[model samples]
Target chain A: MQMTKIKHHLTDALLMGYAAGTLPEAFNLVVATHISMCDTCRAALAEFEAVGGEVMLDAEPVDMAEDALADAMARIMNAPQTSLPKAKPAGGVFPAPLRDYVNGDLDRVKWRKIGGGVSQMVLKTEGGASVRLLRIPAGTAVPDHGHRGTELTLVLQGAFVDETDRFGAGDIEVANEDLNHTPVAEQGADCICLAATDAPLRFNALLPRIAQRFIGI
Target chain B: MLNEMHTLAKADAVTVMPVYKRTGNAGIRATGANRVMAEATTKRMAWVTQVAAVRDAKDKAAFAELFAYFAPRVKSFLMKSGASPDLAEECAQEVMVTLWNKAHLFDPAKASVSTWIFTIARNRRIDLLRKQKRPEPEDLPWGPEAEPEQADAMGLQQETEQLGQALAALPAEQRKLIERAYFGELSHSEIAAETGLPLGTIKSRIRLALERLRHTMK
Candidate 1:
């Protein structure tokens, strides 16, 4: 975790709009995808929705139309049964640039060990940049590492907690090189995170040097 | 009636007519459109119904029951989202009508019916907001209020109470963070600015708040 490498714009946009109910459908879909994999973002969005729900209570009540339900029932009782269209494979794993960050071959990439029970895979982005996926065993504390570039991490499963927050499945943590911190995975589940990085990680310990040489951290 | 029946036959020969017909072009249009839209809506509704069908009539009934339960809730939702009472009522009516017309679209795999319906309400609210030429006051409903004790409103009141209780169970810190972010219309940074807290703290607080809320709701 890097203290200065916080790239929270996507998270910010998602949290804000989700709270406001103003997020676009496409964006909401992406956000949903991210939240499903990342626990931190899910929690954040949930908080936003709850808050919105509360504010709604304070809103002045509106009178419902006389026949709204009857109309709806009439429509439902009369609605014809139909089938869903077939699922189509889009050009990318996801619909946008984010897709490229994921769906890459995980096995072929070089794996670098950064700490005990932690390994990383560095992948090249379309922008000719490199990103890393950091995997830690359950209850392992990742070595304190500072970021050197923009870092976007999406949690595929499990969860980890830092001094400031806890991230779970589908939660994305965006950070820059300036952010410095260490994250410890929760007991009983491995923390697997998909991280897109533009620069090398700055490891804080001598043990990392030995691990980096073989694992490429 | 003859003209509507003619249109219905041309669209989908299998379409069902309303049990009773009202008067005038409005009634004619409603009946005609309902018949046609029901046919059109079923194509999507089937996706949802397929999932519901497997669970049992109890499940199906629960799904079907959503119309009576949520139509007014959605109407009230529209009203709070800045629609007039009348427009909210209209939108609510349309939403339920849509729910009925597209009941088959309910896919339990993709989302719960509540979330799906909420998504529909959300989209409709956005469309309505976009169409407004001049912005009105923050809290006023756009249309005339219907009677509060109306059956629909009463139903909404009950559901809302349940939702409210769920919300209230969240920790005060988490709940307040959610409130400022959603109701207060403050950005994370803005919240940081107003509260004079660090931006990270605000974001973290919001994140924890949401997690707690989800746990409570579940």
Candidate 2:
């Protein structure tokens, strides 16, 4: 069926973390990007947000800084006209939130070849975790590896089949140390993914491991 | 007149019970129910109408209404999630300012005002939290369970209400984990540490709680 349905949607607890403001920025980006594309996750996030609202309403009301309203109004009046940063003009197939990070349309991403027919563009973000976009050629496979830490891979386009399952556009595969599989792109198209990892991967092959030291993959 | 008063008193009594059970405070729940219902309906409309006034017309009155509604609530939320009062208030102001500027991005088809505001407020809070310490890498909190697939769009409102009801019905232990994460702003590892439970237990308990919520809402 060529990846007709998403088999792996984000869980409620993760959505709760995203809604409640606990997830790290990298995870938050993954969740936000997924929510933009997945209707089910979007609806789920809204419910969590509604619950967040209810909880806020139920909290012990703190008396404001006496001039809070006045100051806020003053700031709003003098506020520099800031719009949400425009989505990248090269935002092809990229959702708005992800595009905010990608910063330009598809052509703008300066991909550097890492090795083995796979290239990557590491996104600069403020955190200990790392986020990057990977471009794997058609019919190629990511070096099979386990994670030293959690890894979240969200498909931006095309599809990849691994030992676990197939992930198409908008689907994310959450992998930790216990899971290891090579994600092989289907024959027809290249697979592009936004992947975030907090630690170096445990690559199975000797060559990728040596290259990892230099290439920082 | 006597009969009418009696009927209102009865109506108030009937309305209070479910909410009182949910909130554990009857006096507030009874009062809150009417106000919340009224606001919820207004917010649904505001996503379509009132928000546009702030965006297109620069309508101060419309902006004032949203500010009055969301600002303090956002502050309270940050406070509950571990921000100091001053920080929470400052972040709240930032959230409001961002709201003023980003009003153009408000898409009613995508999300309602509170949900969008919730995203902004929490983003500010999370950014503040991250500045304090980076989290250790860890697994996600369990997984997505099999379900009735996506709830139809028409069912979203009902699903949210049902979700609330289901949350209220959860066993205290499970609900406490949710509260710790949501209100306490603890990550899975931090939550595991604070509660002295194994990380796996925390994830599984939460996963079970969510599965129950999903099934109940479905």
Candidate 3:
């Protein structure tokens, strides 16, 4: 079977930092969001957590204050509940079709229209699971491009098709820089996806030759 | 209730019994009575406000309640991240205390409390790791036992025993790759490099492995 390579750096960074508990709060939020939606990343994270847990069992024990447990509970009894802050998308609430596609702390992404037919939103999650949301206009075709790194894409709405396969809402495609393919939106709709990539896109189109200079697709 | 009281009495005895045993049973009775009174007071006030009431009050009781549930988990997390046990313990306590002080700062609409706590623990763990000098390669803490093979064996054994059943149920290639990556921490590149397979193949294997694991875990 022909295979597609999913980028590894961002996912690896996310798993490593998540396992080590070294991810920053803002980035961690994005990882959590992505994990909520991405089964592959979620399972990868669980494995990392399990490994970390095993490592902890090997560490020497630290004694809490004899009264620490009791004190903690007492404080709990006296504590109060409050509303937590919501993470609003930096650009604004995403359209409904895009919600399932995006993950992580929403505030961290900086969305910019980098191309005529596309808008890109970038998110930095720890361990390199940086996120990019790409929205392609209806009937437009993205430059035939290969990745210099692994890329994972989840379609939130609409449809796109390459020579090998069709991606519809909720379909996930993992690609690498080795395989270059142009994705054209299916008739009558735009294609929006949540993508995690390690490096820039290598545009194969004449337009992108000029376009890539400014956009770094 | 009597069982709980007995446990409390035993715990309290460590400090009080030494003095009471020499001073006479009078002090024991006094201390026991005091514990009973304290326990009763705690129970009565437990209902003073539902823990969730902290949401509106300047102080949040629910945050404390959640911290109590997860702080130990966070402490163990730090230790695993390579913080000395002493450091881990200190950091754990600090996190819980911060939870208390910052309870009002929580915003549930953005992430669950567990996720929020996990983020805090993650940041703190990073801070602690960044401050330390790297350990000598030889001095690196080995697995708790001397047998590296046995450790991997046991880890696989347990993973298979618990997750093995699930593994058996996965596609053959997926299971193999998962065993290699999840248990081995082999990167896709490393897996490909070692197996002499293309990187794409490794990615698919891992992706499939994870998908299977997710289904099994669920």
- Which candidate wins on DockQ? 2
Order by lDDT, highest first: 2, 1, 3
lDDT of 2 by residue, A1-217 (tens): 0222566787666677766767667777777777656645655555567666545654556666756666766787776664554232332577666666776556778899999889999877666677889998989998889998878899878899999888988788988779988999988889999898878899999998999998775
The deviation in Å at residue A90 for candidate 3 is 18
DockQ of candidates 1 onward, in order? 0.13, 0.20, 0.12
Alpha-carbon runs more than 4 Å astray in model 1: A1-13, A23-33, A36-61, A77-83, A86-92, A95-217, B1-69, B101-116, B131-163, B169-184, B191-218
Fnat across every predicted model, in order:
0.21, 0.31, 0.06
The C-alpha RMSD in Å for every predicted model, in order, reads 16.1, 11.1, 16.2
- Please provide, for model 3 over A1-217, each residue's C-alpha lDDT reduced to its tens digit, 9 standing for 90 to 100: 1112322223464454544444333344444434544545644554444433333322344455555545554555566755464443343323222343344333434568877667887544444445667778888887788888766676656778886688875456668756888888887767876776656777766777787777654
* lDDT minimum window of 10 residues, candidate 2 chain A: A82-91
- Better candidate number, 2 or 3, judged by TM-score: 2
Alpha-carbon shift of residue A206 in model 3 (angstroms): 6.4
Compare the candidates by lDDT and give the number of the best one: 2
Interface RMSD of each: 10.2, 9.6, 11.5
Q: Cα lDDT for residue B149, model 3?
A: 30
